[model samples]
Target: MTSGKPISSHLLPLDPRRRRSLAWAAGLALLFPLAW
Candidate 1:
């Protein structure tokens, strides 16, 4: 379980990349409403 903790911590940096992608996707979703 201790070894797994480090691996999980390494994945924390990946969260930001995922968040940026999600933000872009959400922005695109909002743009459709404006266009309509």
Candidate 2:
């Protein structure tokens, strides 16, 4: 959990719109393996 904090803080500077799109892409990436 300690290592995760730095990454979360690092991404906090990004715009909300960018973050939302990034999350959507990550979700699709995760689902793609299962869908195949």
Candidate 3:
């Protein structure tokens, strides 16, 4: 296995929950553009 792939995969998971968190962040950024 590639060492880089193992390390990067740990950092960013392949799951639906991750997308939900990303969307939550975008919503927060839109609501508080200056704070983000």
Candidate 4:
């Protein structure tokens, strides 16, 4: 499994802005389903 995808690539940047945006998107997505 050593040849598999490297998770470090995704977590390398550690950008707070992108993370906050992603968190907002995720929160909205989760709340959207409840609206119906």
Say which candidate scores most in TM-score. Answer: 2
lDDT values, one for every candidate: 0.74, 0.79, 0.68, 0.67
| Top candidate, metric lDDT | 2
Q: Give the per-residue lDDT of model 1 (tens digit) for 1-36.
A: 586477557656787887577668878988999999
Better of 2 and 3 by lDDT: 2
> Which residue pairs collide in model 3, if any?
none
Residue pairs with backbone atoms closer than 3 Å in model 4 (clashes): none
Candidate 2 structure quality by residue, lDDT tens digits, 1-36: 586477567778988888778778878988999899
The ten-residue window of minimal lDDT in model 3 covers 3-12
Q: Quote the lDDT for 18 in model 1.
A: 78
**Every candidate's CA RMSD:** 9.4, 2.7, 7.4, 5.7
- Please report, as a residue range, the 10-residue window in candidate 2 with the lowest summed lDDT: 1-10
Model 3, C-alpha of 5: deviation from truth (Å): 24
lDDT (Cα, 0-100) at 14 in candidate 3 = 54
Candidate 4, residues 1-36, lDDT tens digits: the string is 642235335645778787678668878988999996
Cα misplacement distance, residue 1 of candidate 4 (Å)? 16
Candidate 2 yields a Cα-based lDDT of 0.79
Ranking by TM-score: 2, 4, 1, 3
Off by over 4 Å in 2: 1-7
The deviation in Å at residue 31 for candidate 3 is 0.7
